[model samples]
Target: MSIPTLRMTEDLLVAILLGDSTIQKKSAKHELKFYLPPNKQKILKMYIEKYKLQSLICIEGVNVETDFFIVSNSLVLERIIREWSDGTSVIFLDPRLLKNSTYMLWLCLFGRKVNNQVIIKQNTLTLDTKHTLIYFFEKTMRTSFLRLNAEGHLKVQAIDELLLASIIDNRPSYESLALHELLTDHSKKSFLQKQEKMKEEMREYACF
Candidate 1:
């Protein structure tokens, strides 16, 4: 089996780390281009976390351009504009995480501190994030759905939808070996069974 990979600029890498990356929602590549921000880790800790990434790898600079290999387990954060343009960024979040009102509140407060436009593509249909928590939380449903589908969530339409759509829309992005690996996986659970499971999980998330 093999995995997909990614090769992006360092600035783009930071945007991903911060989860402030963004892209056109219509694009199949939207899964790789969601929004999340980093607020706690120091630079050293962040480096350590990434360096030790089980699903990520940061190789040394060489004479030639570097490429990153990602698989179903990972995603490369999206970049809509130059990282230096401003503080703008985006990342997809886990809907279940929204139960933690503290995180949502912080995002709202941060939006105010920035005092700039904040938009969520799924909600505002624009490239921004300075919006209310409820809006962003709602936006997570759509954005996170694509991401979960890509990551092999059982309820997500596997071969027929997001994964297959990506195969067509993102053929060149995935290497031949990685694509073969993705094409070969077989899940035994029926769609109804998966739905039942997803519903149970949703119940837990809804409690918050």
Candidate 2:
């Protein structure tokens, strides 16, 4: 069976690593393991299928009654482990990996909506990684970032949530569609306002 392109797989892997996944070495092969609640199993499976990944094995957690794990092994995964892992438990992500907005949208699956805003809790991320990711979001997505909370969780605040919704609408993947469901009604209102303003500007330009 053929696997997805390297770039696509790498983006998915990076998004997974940002969530509840880890990389471990067994003998000479590197394995990507994802630990999530049973409720999240469907999303995890959908993500794997969406990426057309191969050799991924899902296993029920032996100790945790409410959780399970998925294990995936591939040479591409090994390359990711070597490039992203710091030879320790901490994973150092390069900001360049944020190029794929679709995968970035998938990262929202790990986030929760609060007060009409989506907040991604990055408590486990290192300081450098957190800052870099914040920079990437602000520079590319027109979003805002809040200072780290008491728990060391960096909160990403979308000043205009519709910007994210627009990205999700364009992708039309399972992950994107799921994230779209989490968007607040305020985003729809904002999107409509932006559309009207754009139309007005276009009409004015045409008049000239």
Candidate 3:
């Protein structure tokens, strides 16, 4: 299956990946969402230019992060799955690290979060078959999976990005040390360890 032409344009410049938006607090009844840091905003643009992925979207919380929504033709998501099966930008890493998950930022974000969860508009790409972003993430896709016991209350289900999100940084070898140090999450020792392992594997090009 051929992927439709993916053109990197301002229109495709969807959202920014700010990092673990995990809600650690439950003050009362409301579930607050995380916002992207302004400092990271510039860096996010840089990351997009650096990686040549203009279509990346911030998929953490319903309408785009700033509550800015663009009504346009988004990618037909199933095209990504088709391309992956046809071996496009699909990166293979240790199975333990990533099980059927493709690390494409768009797929990761789009499948999961919208922006503010405000339901500004129910926008969906025309997949080969109709599929909501959430449905594809939990069921059709492997990179993101729903928890085992959340079947009863599907709305509150927690999906896990099985692989360490750090692996998405596919910079060249010389930058490994820098990326390793910079991408560390001091809160999670395991996350840092995964980065260490990734840095090592990338050194020998074992995981590159």
- lDDT per residue, candidate 1, 98-192, as tens digits? 43222222222122111121221232122333233335444543322222122221111132222332333453222222222222123223333
Better of 1 and 2 by TM-score: 2
Candidate 3 wrong stretches, greater than 4 Å: 1-5, 9-37, 47-131, 138-143, 146-187, 196-208
- What TM-score does each of the candidates earn? 0.22, 0.68, 0.30
**Candidates ranked by TM-score:** 2, 3, 1
Candidate with more favorable, higher lDDT: 2 or 3: 2
RMSD of 1: 17.6
Kindly give the stretch of ten consecutive residues in candidate 3 with the minimal lDDT sum: 116-125
In TM-score terms, which candidate is top?
A: 2
Cα deviation of 11, candidate 1, in Å: 20
For lDDT, candidate 1 versus 3, the one ahead is 3
Candidate 2, clashing residue pairs? none
Q: Count clashing residue pairs in model 2.
A: 0
The parts of candidate 1 lying over 4 Å away from their true place are 1-19, 24-54, 57-94, 97-132, 135-208
Whose lDDT is higher: candidate 1's or candidate 2's? 2
